[model samples]
Target chain A: MKKYVKKAFIDTLPIMAGYIVLGIGFGVVLKSAGYGLGWALAMSVFIFAGSMQYAMVGLLTGGASFLTIAITTFLVNARHLFYGMSMIEKYKDAGARKPYLIFALSDETYSLVCNSDEGRDYYLLVSMFDQIYWIIGSVIGSLLGAIIPFNTEGIDFSLTALFIVVYTDQWLNTKNHVSAIIGIVASVVCLVLCGSDKFLIPAMISIMVLLFVMKKFCIKEEE
Target chain B: MNWYAVIAIAISALVTVSLRAVPFVAFRGNKQLPAFVDYLGKTLPYAIMGMLVIFCLKSTSFALTRGWAPQLIAGALVVVTYVWKKSTILSIVAGTACYMVLIQIVFR
Candidate 1:
């Protein structure tokens, strides 16, 4: 068990850095919005999702309806659906730990757990340690945000920067850019027509339709 | 936080977990996921990621003078930095820093 714990810790060192920093950003965002340590802890503990939690701050601040929040959460996290599909085989025998593993399967954890051939305990340890780093970082950030008096007027653009970097990574790694282009164009169109307040659902629906259409028409396009 | 916000947070966590658990519950063995589902698993991420990029930018105010510059320039910096460095952290920090300066100082 010690060996696996150490192995998980060593393997997830990079994720630790990333999660803690992003967690700090999230905490500051929460603090700026008048939430303090308790709220940050609740969010990082419960949601445990990076991007969606950032969006959640906006959703709550905007006073969006319950239905809107649910749909937006689904849309923001739609990628996890794909992540789970790939992990079904690896996590098959996770057994009692499976539920927490599934629940804690953040994007960073998925990237680590999916590629690993290490057994259940190692995966669980990695997930747990990653979450710990995240929670710790958020608490620190919340405390710091409360005490610091510096101007952080536009720090929320970290979310935007995150999305752009991920998008670019996917774009460079993928062969065909058709679906990516479609996603951008459809979303931009929807945002213009429907407005930012009402754009997400429409953007998601159109992206799915466009992807389906592309699949049907280009049945064997480059794999 | 109000009960409304608390419930909203619960819904977010619930929905997020449900998405992760879907494949496990549905495909409880070597049972093959449908071809379309498999296709989606392969293709949807890039598309959804692309959509998310645009989603983040949807609030860019077009009415303001130089409103587009911060988003545009910062987004370009992210693309360039990521391509150059291939580092997610570096790319985000660089882009975000550029954005902070553009909005807080340059275009303020």
Candidate 2:
């Protein structure tokens, strides 16, 4: 057990590096939205979804309906459904740790879990450690955001920058641009037609439609 | 409002956890995964990341948003820094710091 814990901690350090910073970003955004430390703690513990939590700040502040919140959360986390496909066999013997293992499978955690060949305990430890780092970072960020006395007028731009960094990396790694183009074109058209307030649902619908229609084209690249 | 926030968190958590469990609950015993699901798994991420980029940038004062010059400059700097360095933390920090400076003093 001690051995697995040590290995898990070492394996998850890289994720800790990113999650803490990103969690801090999320916490800061939540704080700026007038939420307190309890809100930050609750979100990190319960929601645990990184980018979705960031997006949630906007929704919460804008007074979005629960239906909107549900759809948005589902759409943003659709990737997890596929992630579950791969983990089915890996986690078949997870036993009681299985549920929490599935719940804690963030992108960073998944990146590590999929590669490691350890038993359930190792996976559980890694997942637990990752969440702990995230919680720590978020709470610290919330505190800092409340007390910091700086002109944070354009701090929100960091969110955009963070997404761009990930987008750029994805662009570089993937040979398929068709899906990427479809996503952008559909969202832009929806934004133009529906406006920012109502564009997300339309954009989501169009993305799904376009991707399904162009499925063969995307599949061809993979093969 | 507090109730709303708590409910939002609970719903988001529920939806996310359910998605994570779909395969475990629905499929078992050597079942072949559908081609469409596999394809979605492959393509949706790139697609969603594309959509997310637009969402994040929409109406931001940066990235040529309403001709916000400083924001556009900082946005470009972030891309360049990430492309060159491949360091996410560095790129975000650099771009954010540059935006603050531009808005605070340089473009002020």
Candidate 3:
């Protein structure tokens, strides 16, 4: 147990850096949006999706309907469906930790756990630590928002940098560029047509449909 | 908390959790996933990562010379640093530090 916990902690160090900064950014955004510490705590603990939580600040400020927020949340996080699918076999025997495993499966957690050969306890510990780092960073950010005097204008770019780094690594490792190209083209088109605010769902749906169709065509050609 | 905030948070939590648990629940039992579904499971990670990169840049406009420059430069630095060093932490931290410096100092 100690070994698993230690391994989990060591593995999560990178995510700790990313989540803390990103969480602080979210907390600062929430503070500037007139939300107090309570809201940051609640969102960090509950919604927990990093990017969606950031977007939720906009929805909360804009007075978006509950339905709109829910739908958008689903769209933003639809990729988790893929993550979960990939992990089904791994988590099949996770037993009591299964629910929390699913609950805390954020993007960073997914990336860590998807390739992990560790035990269930290790995955659980990693997930728990990641959330703790996020919560701590958010609380600190909320507290610091009123105290800090420095400009935090572009700090949010950390999240973008994190994604870019991950994408670069994935690109370098992958043999197939077809799916990557499809995702980029579909998303760019949707972004141009539906606008940034409404492009996510369209891009996701198009990618899914296109991949399915392409798979079918390839299978038929092979037959 | 306000009622609207509570409701939105609850809905977001519900939706996010449901999405995460869908595969486990839907694929309950020993039933195997279809070939295409398996292919997607393997392929989607790379594609989704790509999509997320674009999503992160969605707010920046290329038309505004100043708006996109910092992001593009910082992003390139991130990719190059990662490719060169193969250290995720250093690459992300360096790129983010570069962006923070550019926007707070250089671009200002």
Best candidate (score: DockQ) = 3
Q: lDDT per residue, candidate 2, B4-43, as tens digits?
A: 9999889988998888888778765546557765556567
> What is the docking quality class of candidate 2?
acceptable
Q: List-wise, what DockQ does each model earn? A: 0.54, 0.49, 0.66
TM-scores, in order shown? 0.73, 0.67, 0.86
Per-residue accuracy of model 1 over A14-73 as CA lDDT, tens digit each:
566567777888888988987788888998998898878889888888899999999988
lDDT of 3 at A10: 71
Candidate 1 error regions (>4 Å): A1-36, A49-97, A106-130, A141-145, A216-223, B1-12
Please, what are the lDDT tens digits per residue for candidate 2 over residues A98-129?
98998998766765565557888999999999
In Å, residue A21's CA in model 3 sits off its true spot by 3.0
Off by over 4 Å in 2: A1-39, A49-98, A105-130, A141-145, A152-159, B1-12, B27-30, B61-71
Q: Give a tens-digit lDDT track for model 3, residues A144-171.
A: 8856566666766766776777777766
> On TM-score, who's better, 1 or 3?
3
Ranking of all predicted structures according to lDDT, beginning with the best and ending with the worst: 3, 1, 2
Ranking by DockQ: 3, 1, 2
- What value of lDDT does candidate 1 attain over all alpha carbons? 0.79
Which pairs of residues have clashing backbones in candidate 3?
A: none
